[model samples]
Each structure stands twice: as C-alpha cells, then as structure tokens.
Target: MGCTFRPHFGYCRRISTKVNVLITVSDDIYDVYGTLDELELFTNAVERWDINAMDGLPNYMKICFLALHNSVNEMAFDILKEQELHIIRYFKKRWADLCRAYLLEAKWYYSGGDVPKSIQCYMNETGASEEDAREFIRCLISATWKKMIGEQSMTSPFSKTFIEIEFNLGRMAQCIYQYGDGHGVRNHETKDHLLSLFVQLIPP
Candidate 1:
C-alpha cells in the first residue's frame, strides 16, 4: 500500500488535504451560514464550473469558489500533464454533485420540516429510545463493514490500491466521528487522536 504512493505521496497528501478542507468549508457554508438563494447561486456556479460564475457570489463565497476552482483545476492539470488524460470534467462533475447534495440538505434544513434521518426514522418506526437507535446505527455500520470486507476479497474492477485507499478513508471517517462530530466540534478526544496520528512518533 505504501509503495503504491511512492514518489508522489507528498503531492497526493497535499491535494487530498486541500480537497478535504474545501469540502468542510463548503459543508459549513451550506449547513450553517449561506442563505437559500446564495446556496442556489453557489451550487449553480459549481455545476457550471466557470470562473465568471464567481461574479454574482458574495465576497466570502467568491473567495471559497475561487479556491475550489483553482485547487481542482490545478489537480486536473497535474494529471493531464502526467498521464495525457483530461479529467477536469470528472472533477467538475464530482464537485457539482457534492454541491447539489449540500444544497438539498440546506433546503431541507431551511424548510423547517421534519426530515427524519435514519436514526430518527428507526426510532419513529420502532418506538425505540435514543440509545437503542444509536445501537442500531452501530450495528448497521458493523454490518456495512462486514459487507465491505467481503467485497474486498472478491475480484473488483478497482485496483487493489484504490480499494485500500477507499477502505482507509472509511476507517478515517469512523475514527474521526467516533467521539462525536470530530470534524466540526473541538474536543479533547479528537485533539488527542490527531496528536497521536500526526504529531507523536512511535519507537522503532
């Protein structure tokens, strides 16, 4: 797995970090800050994947969109130079899809209607307590992991490295959110986890 990333690991890591940061910022904007109309404009701009679309966005949004556009296009440019393959359309579509999903979430939130999430739906249908609903979610996660592991053992169209990366990403998300909204909330556990992962070195 480590060998698969040789020579370009630092570059890949940097791009991944930038992309994740952008995603977090975009999520925050759609979830807590941006107005419905503003979100619509932002989503449209992402879908269009045009720098000119930045003109109508607010100052903060303009900054965010430009960063996203530049970072993504830079990645696409790197790939094109290395592989002679144009992938900007795929990257743009992914960003557009993510923004559209966020826009839908914002719409649901601003609508002020009861949008039952999986846990809520389970609780509502089963008359389960919150704790039970949480346990149910845990079970579901465990089951999903089992399925993922099973699938990994079978022949897959994805390369082994790609599958490994995908699995690691899932694990990373689980670890991050295990303590509770680790990405959004500042807590001691998350701090400790980050320190262990990135700061502390193990004895050889």
Candidate 2:
C-alpha cells in the first residue's frame, strides 16, 4: 500500500478501507447474527440499492443497510464528480452478487448439511490428497495473478494509477488470506504482518 503521498491516494485508501469494513459487517450479519428471514430482507434491500427498501428490515439490519447505501452512494458521487463516470451501477451489481452468495451460504447452513469448501471440493472431485488439493489451489492462484499482470500490461481506458490500485487490491487480499480468513478471524500471523507493515521500523 506504499505510495508517494498524495491526497488522491489517501482518499482512495480511506474509501477502500471503509468498503472492506462494511463488507466484514455484512458478512457477520449473514454468517453469525441474522436469521434467514431477516437476511432475506437485508439482501433484498441491498439488491434494490435504494433507501426506500429499508422499510422492512429489522433495526440492526436497517442501520447496516443505511450505512452501506450511504457509503456506496458517497463513493459513487465522488467518482462521478472526479472521473465523470457513472459507476454506481457497477458497484451495485457487485454488492448484489456478494449478498446473493452470502444468502446462499446461509441457506446451506440452515439446511443442516455440511458444504465442502474449495479445497475439499477439489479433493473430492479429483480423489487427491489434501496437500495435492492445496497445491492445485496455489497453482490456480498463481495463474490468476499472471492473468491480472497480463491485463495490466495491455491497453485500457483506465488510468495507470487506477490500474495499479486495482492490482494492489488483489495483492492485499493475497497477503491477508495467505494463512487463512484473516479478515474474518483475528490471528497472530495477520496481527504480526500488519504490525510489521504499518507499525514497525526497519534497521538500516
């Protein structure tokens, strides 16, 4: 996340962090707290992407939905003002997709059936060992990174800074989840990584 100090860069980082925090809050609501009916209402509100949709949501969900709506709208407003691009539709689609995925997972949980994770699915499909599945997953990740790098090298309408920011987001996710779901669960490894990057000093 290192960059030459610029107001634009600082604003981008702040908005990114805010979105990530909102995502974590949404995930917790889906996975830990909200009942199926409440989750449905919340997901529908998000899918609608309208303040008016908040009417049916419970109190907690109403607060979360309003926060998400306001933050996303504010970001969209900034982008529209600066870039002259109407990207709210793109943002809304992504959020809707995320909520749909979360809702599916919640449905799975309430059904009382164990769902195999990606690693397990790979192992089951290929009759591979756990280690082999992990290696396969690593290979897939590497290939995806290669593709992203290739895309970065190609021509695009986006500015170089914007492309780099998008690429860095992928890198950030890799670092955070390198060990596990670091964002979802606090672990010593993630704590140490953050500390070293943001808090600690290097000796010359």
Candidate 3:
C-alpha cells in the first residue's frame, strides 16, 4: 500500500497507516473494554479535551484516553505545522461522535430487550421488521459510500494526497468489515485473506 501510494506523497502513507491503527484501537476500547459508566466518562473527556476529566476513570480507561488524546493531538500538530491546516477540532468531534455511537450500542446490549444484532435504532425506533431494518441499513450504507466516492472528485481545501488517503481508509474499512468483524476476531478466512495480501509473494 505504501509503495503504491508513495508517488502521491510518502508522508501520507505514514499518517494514514497511523490513523487506521488508531481507529482499530479505538474500536476495541469502545467494544471490549468499556462499561456504560466508563465509556460515558471517557466520551465526555474527549469531548471536553480535558485531562482533568480523566478523574474517576479506571486506570485502564485513563491509559486509553491519554493514548488517544496525545496521539491525535500530535498528529494534528504535525498537520498544522506541515500544511498550515488545523484539523484538531474535526478530529476531536469525530472521536466524540464515535464514542456516542458506541455508547448507544453498549446501552442496547445492556437493555433487557431482544434487540437485533445490528441497526438497533432502526429496529427499536420505528418498530420495523427485521427485513425492513436490513433493507434500510443497506440503503444507508450505499448512500454513505456514494457520498464518500463523490468527495473524491470534489474541490476541497485538503491536499490531493490527503483526499486519496481518506478514500483508502474507507476502502480498508470495507475490506475488514465486509465479512464481519474480521479485525477484532480471528477466523480462518480472515487469516487467509491477510496472508494472501501481506504474506504470500506474487511474481511479476
């Protein structure tokens, strides 16, 4: 991936890779480690951008929050210094939003109802049948993809390399989640997929 995108800008490769890793780690923090109370505290801390907000959090949560906070800020600083672009606010907001979404899922899991595995909102809010909820989600995913693809051709304040990196991030996510939570859980197919892409050699 780095070699393929190097001509566009080698720096983008490093930043994009870091961002992807951060995304996965953040997902685990929300999915695996967080309890309702802890996740709420952490989410609020991120939204507030306050180290003081770390008070009362578990040690593990503090560590996760600090890592996310510092790494994102550092990356934002690098972007500002190098490109004169300040995107820290956007990054912070995105993190907060993601945490809220995860919190919703966690709440649903704790709820005593037999909630559908995905699209809980669609299932719970509108009293939609499972089939209808699935269809709605499919359309929503298609719309999101359309929006992202449309951005590829738009006139943006960001650099072309940055735009390409964003596109690649979306593509990577699609690949990882296409067959389920492939990144979070190991399975034979996921292992084979990774090996085929990263381990097996292909002759020119």
Best by TM-score: 2
TM-score of 1: 0.86
lDDT rank order: 2, 1, 3
- Among residues 3 or more apart in sequence or in different chains, the pairs in candidate 2 whose N, CA or C atoms overlap within 3 Å are none
Candidate 3 residue-wise lDDT, 1-204, digit = tens: 322356656665666677667677767777777888888888889889889999989998888788888988998999899899999999999988887887777777777544356767788898999789988987987899999888778788997766766667667766776666677777677777878988999878
**Model 2, span 145-168: residue lDDT tens:** 999888887889999887777777
Q: Per-residue lDDT tens digits of candidate 1, residues 1-204?
A: 112345656776677779888998999889888999999999999999988987888999999999999999999999999999999999999999999988888888888955467788999999999999999999999999999999988999998877877887888888888878787888899889989977999779
Once fitted onto the true fold, the runs of candidate 3 whose alpha carbons sit more than 4 angstroms away are 1-4, 113-163
- List runs of model 2 lying over 4 Å from the truth: 1-7
For model 3, where is the 10-residue window of minimal lDDT?
Answer: 1-10
TM-score of 3: 0.72
Clash counts for the predictions, in order: 0, 0, 0
- 194: Cα error in model 2, Å: 1.5
CA lDDT of each candidate? 0.87, 0.88, 0.78
